[model samples]
Target: MKRREAREKAIQTLFQLENTELSVDEAITYITEEPTNSFYELLVRGTVQNQEAIDNTLTGSLENWSLDRLPKIERTVLRLAVFELLYNEDVPDRVVLNEAIELCKTFGDEKSGRFVNGVLSKLTKK
Candidate 1:
């Protein structure tokens, strides 16, 4: 799978893990078993391990919107995209934003793509 596809799968897996009470190890096992590109295993693992810190950073960056108030799919996309933006220096911010927007378009509500883009744009400025 391409990097974009891998990122999308990672976002979906992360969303699944977030909605469930699964342990990180269990979540990782489940996610990796799915058909995905090899490039994303480490990325997914890192994102899961650092999720709390990522969420905290996102919460701080969001202006009027608390993380809880956002839809779950949107929050999950932001978490994955922000992790890439803040922690993965090798990935360009534009790529992160684009992939996040794509994920929103695929998995989120009609307005979520633009919403994700707006939030990520704000985050990059910070």
Candidate 2:
């Protein structure tokens, strides 16, 4: 899969994991098609394994918005993006941010992209 397709799949899988009783392993199995991409696997596993820290990192960056108050789609998108930002050193910061915003735009509500951008911009500065 293309990296963008993998990222989008990660977001969808992450969304499922967040909203359901599914464990990370189950979510990964549930989402992966045959010939799974390595990056997609890394994203879901890394994001789930580091969820608390990731959420806490974003909690401070969000302006006037608590983590729980954000819609699940937005929260999941942020989690996946922040995981990449923190863990994937090879990926450029601008690419991570732009891709996250694009995912938010495509999968989240109307304001999700801007909200994601604002939060990410602050977090990246730190």
Candidate 3:
């Protein structure tokens, strides 16, 4: 699978965790069984290991939009993108931002793409 596809799967997995009270190991196992490439595993591991920090940063970034207020899909996508932007030095910031916008277009509401862009842009500045 392509990196974008893997990232999408990771986003879905993270979103599932957000909705449920599943343990991180349980969530990782659930997502890993899906038919995805190696990149998916890496993203899942990275996101799981850093989820708390990621959520804290995300919550701080959204001045008016609380993390829970955003649509689930949008929240997951943004978390994944923000993780990449803030921690994954291998991925370019532009690529992270673009992939996030694509994810919003694919799985989020009509306004989500712009909302993600705005939040990510703010994150990049910090």
Candidate 4:
């Protein structure tokens, strides 16, 4: 799958994992019709593996928002975006930020794009 598709799927996987007790394998199946790719595995597993650090990073970047205060979709979108921004060094920061905002817009509320962009812009500046 393309990186974009994988990223979206990874967000879905994270959402599924967050909402249910399903294992990562099960969550992967929950989101995808195609077989999961390396990027998909990388994002989902890496995010899970590094969740504490990622959440800490987000908490610091957020102006007044706590991690738990974010809507579920927005929260999951942030998780995916932060993982890519921190770990996927080969992808351009602009691409990661744009893809994340696009993902939030696609899967989250109307305000999701701007909210994600604002938070991620702070993270990007670091």
Candidate 2 TM-score versus the reference: 0.94
lDDT of 4 by residue, 33-99 (tens): 6777888899999999999999999999998889998999988988888988888898898998899
Q: Evaluated with TM-score, which candidate comes out highest? A: 4
lDDT of 1 at 107: 92
- Evaluate model 4: give its lDDT: 0.89
Q: Write the per-residue lDDT of candidate 2 for residues 4-121, one digit (tens) a residue.
A: 9999889989999877999877877788756678998888889999999999899889888899999998899899889999999979989998998899888986699988888898
- Reference-based lDDT, each prediction: 0.83, 0.89, 0.82, 0.89
- Model 4 root mean square deviation, Cα atoms: 1.0
Q: Is candidate 1 or candidate 3 better by lDDT?
A: 1
| Candidate 1: residue 66 lDDT (0-100) | 97
TM-score of each: 0.87, 0.94, 0.85, 0.95
Instruction: State how far residue 52 of model 2 sits from its true place (Å).
Output: 0.9
Model 3 Cα lDDT, one tens digit per residue, 9-126: 7887788888899986687678767555667777777777787898899988898878878888887888788778777899999999999999888888669999999989888889
**Candidate 4 TM-score versus the reference:** 0.95
